[model samples]
Target: MSEMVSHSYPRVALIGECMIELQQHANGTLKQSFGGDTLNTAVYLSRLLGSAAQVDYVTALGDDSFSDAMCQVWTDEGIGLSRVQRLPGRLPGLYCIQTDASGERRFLYWRNEAAVRECFTTPAAEPVLAALPDYDVLYFSGITLAVLGETGRARLLSTLGDARDRGARVVFDNNYRPRLWRSVEQARQAYRAVMHEVDLALLTEEDEQALFDYSDGEQILQTYRAMGVSEVVVKRGAQSCLVSVDDRRYEVPAHTVQKVIDTTAAGDSFSAAYLARRLRGGSPKDAADAGHQLASLVIQHPGALIPRSVMPV
Candidate 1:
């Protein structure tokens, strides 16, 4: 297979939901915004790849003002919206974040009836599924699986198979949230099913430990290797990241952030930069370096998205 970055331009699609994000301040003020793990990655990926790749976000949204604003922001970031589904009468989910003095963040979610939960199950989803295979890359996270529910997940699995058969590479982010599923066993089953189709997996070590109870990095790496995933990157915050590709291993140290103002999208940003660099012809090590570089900058900001002016050159 050719290097992902070898193509002059490629089409990449990311699947997940974006919610209305509120940052609750110590003074009890709330700053309304929008963010989601996959959406965060999409924004950063589009920024990093520029015109070199066509980045699209695939999700269901309400035909409300919040959805309108979200679409506008995505367009401003150069992300394509052809794959987005706008459900009538429904609204996007909402979440609020509170950060401690140490800059650690906690979240409260209110997404049960979000339009994205019916994303792949609705009648309108059929055409979107049909067009997914045309992209060069298909990316989604574990949160996506949880929101899709069983029926949507089955449809997604079938769509993944067809996309893979069409030579589209599948990228997965292990953004596991236990509260999203009925039980750990159910989440495990869903993750296992999706893992089989993943070509590149960007995982956080702590999420692996929480989800699978895996003892250490070696076991996690071996499990992904067993799943036939050719490339895996284990992100360890504040420590070195581990990369496994074709039986070779590389340890790339993370860039240290002097003070983390907010760690909201650290992993998401890292995955975006890593994938963007790889798509731009950087080697695994170089890609990891890019991931760390971007993540380091992101943590200095107060939200999931930093200003465009502060973006690294």
Candidate 2:
């Protein structure tokens, strides 16, 4: 649980919302695509950090044609759409998914007036929240604070406290939905207001037992190391994947899928190969074994992406 140097390229960004999917099937056909959970972890962290890193995805889209094929599939998966935004008569936001017989899934949304709920509250989001504090990693989730309501989550918590006061490295991904919040104490006060500008959380022990009901996984890793979050990571889908990292703890193990068929972006491709193997330096148990070997090859494939030549080398 050490090695995390990272910075030969690192620029990442990933805010949220990128809907327009459909899926359905069971003989009642459908299947269009383009997912969300932080755009499926920004298309698997731009196909696992292809040029070392510079992911970029922010959000807000419209000028239809499914927002120009979701910006030509994030510009053919190299991501970096210079912080996308498009608004005008707005659109982007829709869902469907259905999957039964074990691959478990069931959404249905239509996104309350999407266009990323005014992505950071327009005025062209004040230069995309002032160039997102010059990113070096700044992911987003908990369904991006339940679709950035309260004025785009107070301008994304003041651009995540000025991108962690310049040292950047926010990263968080609880993913909880609870019918897009309005209670559960307003999603635990918007997840304790960004858990003190989180520095790598990636949680999901059933979304910390349905948002802070804490059914002890060491009390959700000592409540995200008592809210200072110095690398937490819980995951736990098909068992083992703990990794605390600052007071050291580990767990790992999870890759025995004989068949899954589609658990829709299994934890967004295991938080994109555990943040592309911890931004390439690897070692939080080798980035949770490259996030359980790319979420056991993305739930044996179906949607939420999986086919950049069946990656994983």
lDDT of 1 by residue, 272-296 (tens): 9999988887889999999999999
Once model 2 is optimally superposed onto the true structure by TM-score, how far is the C-alpha of residue 134 displaced, in angstroms?
Answer: 7.8
**lDDT (C-alpha, whole model) for all candidates:** 0.92, 0.84
Candidate 2 per-residue C-alpha lDDT over 86-116 given as tens digits, one digit per residue, 9 for 90 to 100: 8788898898988788757788889998888
What lDDT does model 1 reach? 0.92
TM-score of each: 0.97, 0.35
Among all windows of ten consecutive residues in candidate 2, which has the lowest summed lDDT?
1-10
What is the model-wide C-alpha lDDT for candidate 2?
Answer: 0.84
- Pairs clashing within candidate 2: 141-144
**Model 2 misplaced stretches (Cα beyond 4 Å):** 1-13, 24-26, 29-34, 42-58, 61-88, 93-122, 134-136, 139-165, 170-254, 263-267, 276-282, 297-313
Best-matching candidate per lDDT: 1
